[model samples]
Target: MIALLPLAVILPMIGAGVTMVASRRPRVQRALSVTALAAQLAVALIMLVVVDDRGPMVMHIGGWSAPFGITLVADRLAAFMLVVSTIVTLAVLIYSISQGRDDEEEDGTNSETPTSIFHPTFLILATGVSNAFLAGDLFNLFVSFEILLTASYVLLTLGGTTERLRAGAPYIVVSLLSSLIFLSGVAMVYAATGTVNLADLATKIDSVPPGIKATIAAILLTAFGVKAAVFPMSAWLPDSYPTAPAPVTAVFAGLLTKVGVYAIIRVQTLLFPGMFTTVLMVAAGATMLVGILGAIVQPGIKRMLSFTLVSHIGYMLFGVAIGSEAGVAAAIYYVAHHILVQTALFLGAGLIERVAGSTVLARLGGLAAAAPVLAVLFFIPAMNLAGVPPFSGFLGKVGLFEAALEGSTGAAQVLPLVIVCLGTLTSLLTLYAIVRVWGRAFWRPVPQAGEEHPPTGPLDPRGDHPMTTQYTESRRRAREAARRRMAAAEAARLPLGMVGATTAVVTVGLVLTVGAGPIYGLAERAAGNLMDQQTYVRAVMDTPADGAADLLIDPPGLSPAEPTAQDPGGTG
Candidate 1:
């Protein structure tokens, strides 16, 4: 059964290759891609259940021994991430099919370029993600990143339009540079240590001097920081992600940077275990500040959402930087919650752009006039993103705060205190940004005859507003009924095949919240297993090393997750 685990990853890689060859046909590609992802998701879910019941599962490729051949292992944490990544991919893929249909129908085009390219690259992206999470070796992790990055370059520029070109170029440049830096770090690590296997490195870290390990750690962190959109390295993300078409934007929002977070978690815990505190704390502080500040300044709905995504990412990193079981659990919980809420919000943002005629708040108005049900959808996830209570977001944040509180540091009082203040302020800023979107885009009236050509204002941290009554009685009544018929329209709007793809994926996110208790338990158990490292080592290697292991990752502060080292599935 464990040997079969690698086949799950293999299936999607094969599916992606086949889809790439058949890109000229949209329907065949959709059928195969959805089938591939559905199968992957099923496998991931099965693995999750199996791991829960039977403990972590590990497989060595080419029948090589642990820390020798490539190892694909599934622990509870990684399994949870596999499920999340696969689910997000499935959901947004369906959204893409619906997104481009209008032009396809209008132009008598059966195969739109972006829609056709979407399936192949999306599956490839999924494959890369699964590989990253399952990789037991550092070099294999690097390879996983390259696969994901290459797929992203295609997906990011799917349509090859001027706007996409403008957006994608920076993403490509930055991403490529980051990859190179990461590669350089990988080379240095191999030179310094005999093997690149994570478990091996963990056991071997005592042999490396602090200075040598620090240099390697700095190199890897910079590369992944760029990938994750941390503070200074985040410029490309807000610009690129927002300008892509909606479904692409949604997936990018939901999945891409999260991978970077996964990498950061992997490297900091597994590679530089105890040394992550000062630098990570500083990075987390800056990332949250700058990201939310950027969000505050962005004018359009997606752009704001994009910036906030980067901002809130810092919260999870803060937990990891703190490095305790509770912190890691918080990070994991947040990741699961954020994937759903962020993707949902981005998709809803796309709906706003389509129905409202613009993504900027200034141009939109009184969607309550036409699409109030969407307003509710938008509202739920937006509030969730803001870390409001009763939703998973709030719970995740509270957990992190508690972890931060219990841990002691020289700077502890200030860092945790600042985190609390910033969390509140950022939530307010996020709410403020969302409300600004609602004010002009949903609550107020659309511009009257020749009132203004819009998305026409400067991006502002705070926006100006003029209110009006845009919809009359009939329009208002129709808006109220939109809620009841939302699901029907969601189905009717898509052809049968397209509808099925979306329904299946979105259902996963909906279901995640339903089993929140068990999920949190899994996340916490995984965190505990990670902090101690004995369970993970035994799972990967079949036996604990008789002597010292090679990689001695510096665990961060004791307040948060100790930085789990298995693949890219970070708890947060």
Candidate 2:
């Protein structure tokens, strides 16, 4: 079962090449991408069940063992993230295929044209995301980042349109700069600790001088903060995200920043426990306020959603900043919830654009009556994203608030409480932003030419013209056919493939709401595993009791203990 870990990474990589070869046959490419993701999702489920039943699973490539070879570990957190991400990728693949089919029809192109590379690049992106979650060492994590970044470069600039190029340029520059910083941090860690393996670092990092430890933490945090879109480092996300195609934006938004958050969780819990709590809290509050404010001001749906996405990340960071087992658990649950909800919202935004011929709130109207299904699809996830009651979003935030109140004390308590207030305020503001879009874009009547205001005329439930008597019965069929063709061309009525895929993902988000109990229990266990770094170290290193005692390196001022039979790996 541990061997299945690498297959999660390898299968998609292989499929990427296969997809490229089948690119000329769009149907073949689509089949390969979907099959690969389905298989990956199945493997992820197996890993989740196995890891939950047993414990963290580790595999060393070629049996080289420990820090000396490539290592893949699937703990509950990694397994859960992999499963959710694979689901999102699969849904997005179907959505992209639908878009591609529309493009092919519009251009009158045959399947053999090789006009798009969406499938191949998409698979490569999936490979990168899976690899990152499973990475057991720092260098491999860097490699995962590079792999995803390379794939994203292609995906972001897919059509080579002027807007895409402009968006892709800033994204590439920021990503490259962050990569350089990450590599430098990795080098510094290796230099100080003599190992880039996370398990090894969990032990060795404590022995480093306090100043050096702080430097390394700062460097790594800065690198990840940029990636995670934390406050003051999140300028790149809103602009870069909204310019890409719907599926691209959805996947990037859903998975990419969460990976950074995952890394931060690993770093803070496993490598440097209880460090920089105040700084994290401060950043968390600012990210929430700043991001939501940006969201509130946006006129376009994608840009507004992108800003809200950044804002909600602050909620995850709030959990991290609390620095407790409960906090970590809540953050993990929130990450999963956000991934589903955000992806659904973006996909829903795509539907809106299809119906209105734009995402601009001012240009859109009457979707509630004209496209009731789309309105429902958009409304559920929109409310979910806004942290509406009885939804996973609300539950996740409540968990974080509970954890914060439970964990904080004295002056520390004040900031966490302040953040709690701000978080609540942000939620209300999010609801306002989402509702503003819904009210203006869906409920309001469509504005007529030369009309100073939208007509308050009653809407027909069947979406008939209010003045139906004006059309002669003889002309009705021809008028209806013309309207049908126009609707199809404009995507006023969405394709089943697109709507079905979006609905599938939205259902998954609802599952998070319905299954929050067992899901959060799994998160609690994962958080415990994260806090007990020794279990992970032992799982990876396979050290004897005596060797484990020697490996134990507690932070300065703390005494190390001998390893017992039950605790072969000493406390990290």
Candidate 3:
């Protein structure tokens, strides 16, 4: 299984090429895409079990060793993420295939011929994601990001519509800016330490001057922060994501930002431990508050979910900031939970759009009455996202809170406690926002066509309230027209593929809840591995004298730190 690590990235790349070759055959493309992802998922699961049982596995590209050539490593953290992400990509691909490109304009865009670029681009995106998780060096990670971002650029503006183009503009700008920052960080890391290999950096970074270390850390954080959509850097997300098609939006929401979070975890735990702790905590609280506040006010369901997506990222960041074994473990668990729930919610939002013809809260109503199954589909994930009890979301939060409390004993207790409070508040407000959507979009009676209403005030001095009546009546007429259009739409029957795929994702979330113990146990061991740097460094660097191992050239004059399992708070 360890030897098969490269297949995670290779399978998708090959799948992308095959998909392009079969682009003329949509069914063939779909079959190829699904088969490739299913294989990748299987490989990832096997890697997870192997790494968890036998420790981190390292694969040197072209028979070159670490710090000298490209390396792909699958540790517990990387393997776990690979499993969760593969599940999401596969589910989203299935859902998209079921929805079909013919329904592309179903999201309200002008009708056009469906493009074949989607399957190839999607597989390429999956390849990028897998590569990022398994990348053993900063430069390889950077390359992985570029691969995915390039694929995303094509996916986001797939149809070349005005809305998608408009959204893609800022998204492209922000992504390019982040990529530039990340590239600069990689350059500086190489210059400072003479290697971009992560395990080697863990050992050698300590020898660099404090100022250089802090500068590199700050630079990397800024770049990854933008990628992760953390708070002030997060403004790009809600505006950018909602314009893409449903499946595109679902996969992006599920995996892309989490990859950034994964990078942040590596940087904080492996390269520069204990740097920027306070900054992460403060950023997490602010991200939660501002994101949820923005969420509650959005008129459209996708935009609202996007904001909540931003808000929940803060939770993951909070866990990283806590920098404890428990904190990181909880964060890891939460990341998996959020990926499934958030993806499901977005898919459910897509279903709602299909059923009601629009996702605008004002334009949507009586969904529960019209499509009860869709109502249930949307409701479960929404509740889970809101951290409702007995769900994985709630359990993940409880773990975070517990970790915070345990870590709050020292002089720095105040900040962690305050963040916990903010996290709780965010959860409550998220529930409120979810409920508001449920009421307006699912419970309230659908507006009748040409429904009439009384004037807001008496007639103006001229005994005619033209301003109020004109504005009010026009808005009312538009709403009624929307209602009539939706009512006239073909019966709201959801495609089995979309619903089954979504339900599959939702079931995975429930599996998280039911299997929280074993899964979180895996997270704890992953967190343990992250805190103990030598387990990773040795796996990559140590060579067996046995001829069974490949010929290796050791990095000269570089002394790695001794093998001591240090806590995340340790200042090396």
Candidate 4:
């Protein structure tokens, strides 16, 4: 398990390179993708157990102690990320493979599904994601971004349709620009401190003037803000995500934006921990307000989900801004829950789009009757995503609220109070949006001869024609079909494996919520790790870089005035 830790990060990369070369051969490409992902899953699982049994493991690549050569470290937090990311990718990749004809998709034989191109890019994308999670230095992290972003550019424009081209172009450009900004931040920090390793930088950062530190942080945040979709910075998200195929959209929504959030969390805690509390507080507030508002205005199925993605970014930041162990723990739990829920929800919508033939509310109808089990799958995450009680979302948010309340001393609690209120408001608004979808698409009657061309029903005196008794007949049919079509769809439709795989993902989502106890504790531990830099440092530190004073941020549990060298951040 110890030796396998380093190999886990490197092996998928080898697979990515191989997939890229063999992409022209469909069979070889699919084999490569499956082999690589399965290998990763194995490594991640092994590492998970190893961490549980033996604690964290650290690796200095090329066997040259830290500071001189790049290091790839895996502590509980890093290992946890690896395990979660690999599992998500495995499931998503399996869904993709099942979705289309393997042979035809690999070679683009029919021109409708290109398996060859997707296999390589998707594998490469997963490799990049895993690398990013394991990266211990700034430059390597940037390299991971490039790998993933390049693969995404390929995936986004895979089909080459005009609507896709429109969406793909902006995504590519924005991502490229963010990369440039991130690279620039790396250069600035390097010039100032002479090392790109995170632990080295932590010890060195304080020697630099506060103003310069803030500038570097601002530049880095700009890049991550764009990536993470933090409020005003997220204009590109909703416009681009829904344009891809269901598999591609699901992975992008699940991983890419969250990576940005991860970066934001890492950067705030590592380089500029001193300023994190205030900066994150403001961003969290605005991110929540703006994201929910965007969802409120959007009318399409995927677009609303996209905006909800934007709003939820604030939840992670809330944990960060709160700057307490409990808050960070909640953020960690939220991350794990949100990743599963969001992916499952998007796939559910994809199923709806497949049957109802549109993601827009106006074009969709009577699907609850058409596919009833599909209704349950789609509805559970919708409720959970909105933070409904007894689900993961509510569980995560309740923790966040506790963190916020505890962070304040009565008077400062006003901001937290407002945050809780806004979280509730966000939930209410999200419920309104999803319910609006249900009313229009599921409950309302299927179109009659004349109503096919007309709006489903007459406008009321108030100009609002909401779901009413008109749905009684449709509701009855919806229930029956919901029970029947679930098995029927998977049992019948042989062409779209995406359909079956999506159904399976929904089952997994339910399981995650039901088993949230162990998962929640893991997240809390991760948050605790994140807030305390020394633990991560001691885990990753080899020969400390000379510029130590400028970079150090004490880990969460330690007192600011009394840092111990043998503590988590110290050199072994």
Q: What does candidate 4's lDDT look like per residue over 111-201, in tens digits?
A: 4347767777887898788888778888989998999999999888778899888998889889999999999999999999998888788
Model 1, span 499-534: residue lDDT tens? 343344344444555676888888897787678776
Clashes of each: 30, 0, 0, 36
lDDT of 3 by residue, 405-489 (tens): 8946777788999999999999999999999999998898876543333346667787765676576677778777766755644
- TM-score of model number 1: 0.85
- TM-score for each candidate, following the candidate numbering: 0.85, 0.88, 0.91, 0.85
lDDT for 486 in candidate 4 is: 37
In order, the Cα lDDT scores of the candidates are 0.74, 0.85, 0.88, 0.76
- Superposed model 4: Cα runs more than 4 Å off: 102-112, 449-496, 543-572
Q: Write the per-residue lDDT of candidate 2 for residues 398-429, one digit (tens) a residue.
A: 99999999845897689889999999999999
Q: Which of 1 and 4 is the better model by lDDT?
A: 4
Prediction 1 global C-alpha lDDT: 0.74
